[model samples]
Target: MVGHVVRKRLYILVFAALIGLTALTTGVAFIDLGKWNTLAALAIAVSKASLVVLFFMHLRWSSGLMRMVLLAAFVWFAILVALTLSDEFTRQWTPVPSSWQAQVQQQAR
Candidate 1:
């Protein structure tokens, strides 16, 4: 049986890239970009994950059926995350009335 062979040099390069991306993620964590920080961190994380999956996981040399399955999995994950985030972001949290607060305090005691 024939098998696919990955070169050592390519593996080393991918390893270096993953390490560099990790450093970038850590560096970005120290800076306060407010809302943009999450987006930046997620982008870097996705990049790193992609590199690992493509090289180390051998997805790059995989068959079309395997790629299709992986794509479906990613789509499902995105859908779930989107639904959860939408529900969380759309909720309205209203403050409780003073009477209710008093009742809560009395109940606690």
Candidate 2:
């Protein structure tokens, strides 16, 4: 009974922290961060998600196996994002074939 109350209090604290983080994120969005915008947004999002998982989901008190599962999920998501970004950023530097450009020019003529 008392444990449940403590858990609820902890959840309230986590919610407050999440709200603070959200405000910070919104504040940062108004500033000219240049290339840091994406990084800052991702950092705040991860922090908020961590708090939710730790308190709301009760992962903090869970067993090792559960923790590992959570870690694996994060790892997989990171890998997928990294691979996708790598493809996108790398393609920006590649040049289109002159043959294709010529075909488009001919079609427009």
Candidate 3:
């Protein structure tokens, strides 16, 4: 079976990109971004995944249908990630009652 022959230069470039992105991801890990830390890491991860999929998997030379399917899958993944993060961010927000005010009133009386 015949296929597209990827050039060595392209391979080297992709490898470099993967390495650099990995370094960036590692550096970002030590920094405290608070709530944005997870998002930042995920963004870097998606870029790395894209590089692997497009070059290593040869998806870049594939047909439009294949690309469209991948795009749809990415969209679904994004939706799921967004929903998960939303839940995570809201998890700390528990509803507080007026119990503290009642205690203050009793102390004053």
Candidate 4:
């Protein structure tokens, strides 16, 4: 008998979990948790991504090599994000052009 018996049930459960998490994310958006709102949204997003990767991508059934590759990819992604944020955080703000500032002031009124 084949070992990897594909289960429709598992997919259904994962789908349901993703939907629930999405609803939770939507609900969280309206509440003013201030700093925690971003953290909560990020946590839920990570959970959803993990579910999609493990279940939908069948990474759970993947070989060790595949997992190592995934880990390496994550590391690379982390490096890229860190570098990007570093550049962003160190940037200098320039004064807006007079014309644009005038437009912005007009819009505010």
Best-fitting candidate, scored by lDDT: 1
Clashing pairs in 2: none
lDDT of 2 by residue, 1-109 (tens): 2332245677678889999999999999999899999999999998998888887877877789999998999899999999999999888576766778789899999
Task: Give per-residue CA lDDT, model 4, range 8-37, as digits (tens).
Answer: 999999999999999999999999998999
Q: What ranking emerges by lDDT with the best candidate at the front? A: 1, 3, 4, 2
RMSD over all Cα atoms, model 1: 3.4
Clashing pairs in 1: none
lDDT of 2 at 43: 96
What TM-score, computed on C-alpha atoms, does each candidate reach? 0.84, 0.76, 0.70, 0.80
Superposition error at 52 for model 2 (Å): 0.4
lDDT of 1 by residue, 4-79 (tens): 7999999999999999999999999999999999999999999999999999999999899999999999999999
Score candidate 3 by lDDT: 0.95
Residues 1-109 of candidate 3 have per-residue lDDT tens digits of: 7788999999999999999999999999999999999999989998999999999999999989999999999899989989999999888776777689898999999
Which is the winner by lDDT between candidate 2 and candidate 3?
3
Q: What is the lDDT of candidate 4?
A: 0.93
**Cα deviation of 49 in candidate 1 (Å)?**
0.3
Candidate 2: stretches off by over 4 Å: 1-5, 93-109
Q: In terms of TM-score, how similar is model 1 to the real structure? A: 0.84
TM-score of 2: 0.76
